[model samples]
Target: MDLTGTQRAGATPTWYEDALAWACRPVHHTTDISPLRAHAQAVGHTDGYRPHPPHRTRRHP
Candidate 1:
């Protein structure tokens, strides 16, 4: 957690945990509400969102 410590200075950075010797669990992201927030900032399509997800935008037609 502390990058400023002396331990990291002389040695290569290692994984924070050992894979073979330990168990792991997923750390849940608290929120991903950027889309709603962005849409609100763009004022409900009156100003428009400039970039959309790539697959939504184009076709060979």
Candidate 2:
């Protein structure tokens, strides 16, 4: 990932330019929850959701 020439002369490699373009491309999101739940189940997350433990507060004398 040497970008000395690109940094100095404002020249970029084709692959680097293409990757930047692809990374900046817009992505659409799906509103369906069924597929998401199915994927979660496949990954063995059938225990539903759990919350983290509460933090303890310090007391002042």
Candidate 3:
């Protein structure tokens, strides 16, 4: 699938403005966060959220 971002010169969309629009609409059948990811995204905190980086990380030596 051609992500809207790909149409731009970047691999990913820089802002969520367009993304939010897409999310609001049921068009294009792609890019919708899965039920599982939606659950993670619904969490207020980023910890353990799949879409977000872990809240804390240990130094990798």
Candidate 4:
């Protein structure tokens, strides 16, 4: 999926702003193990939760 950040034109849309805010939201570190991460760890025996690798995009001049 193409993130809204790079697709915006003049006068940013509310959805794009919301998505940007969500993406830039502060994250707090804690000892807590999210249920989803815990389940994944339990099933996959991973050391921790890892998100998918970033998507690569091409820039056209």
Candidate 5:
């Protein structure tokens, strides 16, 4: 998969996938990782951290 494309309309940033790959790589070797730790690793891979849309939370009625 190509990881060098610029963000297009209605598409996620390119770095997001790279970050995901980085995050998943460690899981293949280790089995006792926490989700929070994996998330942190993903975020760290995004160079300088690109501004992303805020995660939407479902409102309970």
Candidate 6:
């Protein structure tokens, strides 16, 4: 049978016919949160150690 273009030899749909096919399957996705957590912790630590000035003054005469 000529399966080129819109030609179908049977009653099965295009997707149904390729149910067990892995070539058109969705890929597995994953995200790593360790780096983000480390950055947040570093920022928090720096914020606690730094002292804020009580007043602002012009240094230039």
| Best model number under lDDT | 5
**Model 3 Cα lDDT, one tens digit per residue, 1-61:** 5557556667355455455444444333545433223233554753331342223335767
**Relative to the true structure, how large is the alpha-carbon lDDT of every model?**
0.34, 0.42, 0.42, 0.43, 0.44, 0.35
lDDT of 2 by residue, 1-61 (tens): 5668657477544765455445444334523222122223456554333332333356678
The digit string of per-residue lDDT tens for model 4 on 1-61 reads 6546556554455875455444444344533322222114465464533333343356778
Steric collisions counted per model: 0, 0, 0, 0, 0, 0
Give the lDDT of residue 46 in candidate 3: 35
Tens-place lDDT digits, model 5, residues 1-61: 6433454454655756666655444343555442223333464453433233233347778
Cα TM-score per model: 0.17, 0.26, 0.22, 0.26, 0.24, 0.15
Better of 4 and 5 by lDDT: 5
lDDT per residue as tens, model 1, 1-61 = 5656666675454543242112222223323322212234554453332232223324677
Ranking by lDDT: 5, 4, 2, 3, 6, 1
Error of 1 at 59 (Å): 61
Q: Considering TM-score, which of the candidate structures 3 and 6 is the better prediction for this target?
A: 3
Location of the lowest summed lDDT over 10 successive residues in candidate 5: 32-41
- What TM-score should be assigned to candidate 6? 0.15
Runs off by more than 4 Å, candidate 5: 1-13, 27-61
RMSD of 2: 16.1
Model 6: residues with Cα > 4 Å off, grouped in runs: 1-7, 14-21, 24-61
Residue 39 of model 1 has an lDDT of 30
Task: Go through the candidates in order and give the C-alpha RMSD of each one to the true structure.
Answer: 16.6, 16.1, 12.3, 15.8, 14.0, 21.9
